[model samples]
Each structure stands twice: as C-alpha cells, then as structure tokens.
Target: MKGLIVRIAAAVVLGAAIVTGSPGVGMAADATALIRAAFDNWRANSSESTVTMTIHRPGWERHLTMKGWTQGHDKALARFTAPAKDAGNATLKLGKTTLIFNPKLNQVIKLPASMLAQSWMGSDFSYNDLSKAEDILTEYSHKIIGTGHAGGHTVYSIEALPKPGAPVVWGKQQVKVRDDGVLLQETFFDQDMRVVRQMTTDKVGRIGGRDYPVVVTMRPAAKKGQWTRLDTTAARFNVPIPAYVFTRSNLQNPRN
Candidate 1:
C-alpha cells in the first residue's frame, strides 16, 4: 500500500516530459531535479490507482488487489480491496507518521520509528518503501555517473548516497532513469557495500492514456526464487482527491 502505481505514473509522466527536459545524448540533468521529476510527475496534486501485487515465494505465490490515493507528497492511503482475507487492511502515511488499520482487529495502530524498516505484510517492500520512498530527494546526495542511449531515449544512471545521520536504511541507492524521467531500476546496497535488493522494470506500456511501467519486480539478492512483483493495473493522475481520504478514520472505516 505504498505509492507503487503513483511512482509508475511518474515514469509515464516523465515519458511525456521530453518536450521540456533534455532527451538526447550529451545532455546533463540536475541530479536532484531528475529525482524530483520522476517523483513529482505522477503525484502532482493527487492520484488514484489500482494495483495488483504478487508475492513469489519458493513454493507458492500470493496475489493482492489494492487501491491507493495520494494528495501531494505528505499524505497517502493504500487499502487492500480484494483477496477477501486481506480486505479492509490499510496503511496511511502523513508526513513522518505511518499507521496501519487492521479491520480484523478493528484497530488503528501507529508504527514506531524502528519498525519503518521492517517488511510490509510479509512482502519484500519495507514499511519505509511504503511511507518514505521519496526520501532520496532530500536525504541523499545524488550524482549522475553514466549515460547511454536506449530505444531512442537517453538513459542516465545516478548514485545516491545517504547524507550523514539521515534516518535512512540503505547505505547507497543506484537509480537509472530515462531522459523523459522514467525510472528504469533502483538497486540497494547494504552498509558494507553489498547488494541487498533491487527493483527492476519488466515492462513499460501505455495505461490510462499515459506511458507507464506496467510491471515491476523486487528481488532480494540473498534469496533465491523469492521476489515480489507489482503490476499497476489502472491509474488516474492529478485527479482531485478529497481531503478526508487521508484521515485515520477513513483508513479504518470507508468513505472513498
């Protein structure tokens, strides 16, 4: 229940930004701006989306259907809508706080700072990915180190190093983006500089009249035959989202 599709929406919006941003070889992009462009594109004023998440384990797989809403960068709510057992479960993020709503328990629980790095619902995505996926823009120093041409587009590889004392989990993050602002992939490294996990785009296509990453997979380096795939089924960007949508009560109850 993170900004999964919203991020995908960013990729598509970037695909359309070729008119304003550079789109050829030898062009330079402001590292921070590049990061911001991808993040801000899809979540401009607000967004609503439907996504399917598939968790691939060594022996079995599980799928989930969820809906999400975002208003600006500070407020968001994602709730599971299908797979009967998981329905009505939700996660809400407001500024620095992240909370969970368990319909089974019928309680709203606030997540502690330490638990932000933990997995979300046994998935590969951490709570941080659900709540603070955009922190790289402000919490790290970024630089573009490589550039190449692919499929009539310029691709830039960026390195993001966490700023000192930042409450971030990764020691380093490498991001690859297309000139139009599409996020190609993101690789995470541990404090000892070892690869921990990575998220890669498997397919990019048009959805809801927008170019987007339709399939993205997250894999842990240490685990074999185990990964999570996120499919952005549908999306509507920059849509008017009601203010009440981000409230804790809405996360627990239903008002969307």
Candidate 2:
C-alpha cells in the first residue's frame, strides 16, 4: 500500500507540471506572433512618404527634407529634396546591397559592409538601421518580458535576442508595442549588452488610414544634447511604385 501511494503522488506531480508548462509555451508563441503581425502592419506592400528630418547637435542644428519609397523590406529609395547642399542626394537599397548617389561627384557608390554603421546623410540613422525592418522578426527570437501603459494604451515589452549565426550587430533589442500593433519604442544594445541607442515615437496619429507614429526621434546613448527627429509630412500606403524607381539610373535621374 505504501509503494502504491508513492507512485500515485508522483503521477499527480507530473500532471501538474505539464499543465503549468503549456501556458508558458503558448504565451511565448503568442508574443512572437504579435511581433510579426506588428511588422506586417507597418510594412505594407508599397509606401511613399515625404518627411523632414532635423539633426540636433550641441552647437548646431540642421533640417533636411526628403521623399521616400519602399516596396517590401528589401527595396527602398530616398532622395533629399531640400537644402541645396544635400539636394539630389539619394540612397537606394536592393536586397543586401546599398548604393548612394552624390550629385556633386556625379557618382553612384556602392556601400560596403564596413560602412553600414556610418550615419546616413549625417542623420542619427545608420544605413544598417534603414535596412533592418525585417530583421527584427526574422533574425531574432522574441519573448514578452513585461508590460506597461503608454498614452493610455497597454503596451507589451518584448526582448529580442539574435539567433545563433545570425548576421546582426546587436546583442539584444528591446521593443515596446501597443496592443493595436503600433511600435512605441525600440532600444538597441551592443554585444556586451550595453545600450547603444534608442528610437521612440514622439507623436502618434492617423496616417493613410492607419494609426502610425508620425514623429519619431533617435538618440545615441552617449551623445547627450544630440538627436535626430523624423517627422512625416505626408504618406500613402499600398500604392503603386514604378519599377524604375528602384534602379541605378533613377538614382540620379528620377522620373515622375
């Protein structure tokens, strides 16, 4: 009778463990799904927008205006349209390769991997940052680490760790997204888990029938009194983009 009672107790303990473990697994899966869904929400089939970027430094400030187009995460083009010095400057990304067009030099230079971390057009955003829209979902494993309230909406705080062998620079990334799929903040860390930089939504509003962050800011961790602010002036989603827009020829000679 004693042996039988011990066996029954063991079975009960095992059953309890299984019941408790399943929810934790399910929660993780749900968090990942939410992240992927948020990416899809932000990245439509095609998009076009006009923006103004302000680079703030301790001693100087400058503003740039540009138009941008993107078709999927792999293809994007941006052309500077304001400030005569930067006018006609453009950058194009096709797959893994990136090219920049300089009106002064009349040259289209392909950016190598070594230049990925450099600031784009002296803005706080790097060439790598512009191209990593899809990597947050594909190259990292995500888990919901905590929760908070922002602008009266519940936000999920997610931690993303790069998968083994993934071609990424950050050791980890922390993101906060609202329940309705709006990205509120994203923080990047170095390999040693030191905070490198962060981007945050400064203003949220309706754009192209979707709730989006119309104004965002990027600030490096060590660079006090310096930041770059991007404000969307206009936007259209799921619109038709001309094929030539993504080609090398169009980098300098853009056609309407």
Candidate 3:
C-alpha cells in the first residue's frame, strides 16, 4: 500500500537470505531482512516476465496479457502485449515519476504524485505499484509479530506500522513470510484499522530455478466478487536488462 503498485507482491520485497535459511530454527530475527527478502524475490535485481491478468467482477471478466521488466527498485515498466486494441499501452516508473503511454492517443502522459494511489488500467493494482515502491516501502517500521510453520518452513507473521508523518495511506500492513522468504499474504488496513483490501498468494511454483508465487489475487475487503488475479506465466530473475527498458521512449516504442 505504501506507493507500490498494489502488487500481489504484498506479494513482498528483496533479499538474498530468503532461500537460504533453515525452517523454524536459526532463522534471522531481522524483520527488515525478511521483508526485503520477499520483496527482492518478487522484483529481484532485474527481471523480465510475461504475465496474464484477469479482472473479475460480479458478472463479467476481462483478461489482459502483458510483458514486464524491472531494473532494481527505481525503475519498472509494463506494456500490454495482447488483444490488439489494448496493445502498446504501457506504464513506466523512474524514480518518483510515473508516465503512461497510450498507443491510441500516441502520447505519453506524466502522472502527478496525487494520482499514484489511483488504479492502473482500471485494475485493483494502483499506479503506485509500478512507481516508487522503495521510497514508500522504507517508510514503515516492521516487526515479527508471530510465527508458525508452513510447507516445512517457518512462517513469520510480520506487522508493519507506518511511522508518524510517513507519506503512506495504510494504518498498518500485515505480512506473512516463509522462512525462505516467500511472501504468503499482505493485508492493508485503513487509519482506523479497518481492513481495506489484501493481496494473497494463490499458488507457489518454481520460476527461474527459484520458488515463486506464480499466481496471486488482489481483492478489496468489501467487494464481494471483484478482484484482479495476476499469473506470472514466464520469468527470468536477476538477469541483465538493456538500459532502454525503463525509458519513456521504450514505453512508447518498444526496442527491448
């Protein structure tokens, strides 16, 4: 919720220790590391992915296919690749700035910071998800609130409270991470502590020779049948990506 693309990544952050530790024992008590591990796994140093997004309402559904790439925490890009009508539509985030390219209009629009909380392409994920996640992610104080076991691994329940005056909207965020640093779920709460929405890991599988949450769903707390699901069809993590990937020109005209 903290400026990240309402990503299933609540769906979590990055760190190398995520896949290294033993289950339930000799685990690092460092909550920051745990969160960083999960986040890192989700984005990694650099990654390229093909994704399928399903948006569901009470009586209708829509699907979109996209290609995505990330360059560390400051840069990311996603462009629709299917359904001819929506093809070439894209968003790019560099530092604190966000811009979207619309092939139909053939224009790139720079989004104001106030619009960061708005949805991205009318989906549950916000523009913030693709924007400056690291800046806002670093605004909270994380703690290991509880612990349990799952799939032969330790599951740490972490709670993140926004620091006073932090530029974040959630009152708190509840995170569940596995010993190996996989994020199982994240719940967002309003300032009054009311549940706002959540991102849950629907399935976990191997990607690029590492365990990953291949399927995840985001559903608002009060919406009955409205949700958005993202399926990471193919991905390669911590790989080298061309510099042009995060540029506005690339968003408008693909070169990678």
What local lDDT does model 3 show for residue 126? 71
Residue 58 miss distance in model 3 (angstroms): 0.5
Please, what's the RMSD in Å of model 3? Answer: 3.5
**lDDT tens string, model 1, 1-256?**
3222224211111011111233332254877766665554445456677778788998899988877776676676778888999999888878888888999999999999888666676777765565335768788999998888877877788899999899877889887777776666788898998999887778776765555556777789999998877787887777778888889879888887
- What lDDT score belongs to each candidate, Candidate 1 first? 0.68, 0.65, 0.70
The TM-score, computed over Cα atoms with residue i paired to residue i, of candidate 2 is 0.86
Higher-ranked by TM-score: 1 or 3: 3
For model 2, how does the per-residue alpha-carbon lDDT over 48-90 read when each residue is reduced to its tens digit?
7777778899999998887777666567777888999989988
Q: Estimate each model's TM-score.
A: 0.89, 0.86, 0.90
Better of 2 and 3 by TM-score: 3
lDDT of 3 by residue, 1-256 (tens): 1122233221111110124222332277678777777766677677677777788999999888887777776677878878788889888877788788999999999999999666777777777665327542599998889999888878888889988889887898888888786778878799999999887778888987688777777789999999987787787877899887878778888996
Candidate 3 residues lying further than 4 Å off, grouped into runs, are: 1-26
TM-score between candidate 3 and the true structure: 0.90
Report lDDT (Cα) of residue 172, candidate 1: 93
Model 3 score (lDDT): 0.70
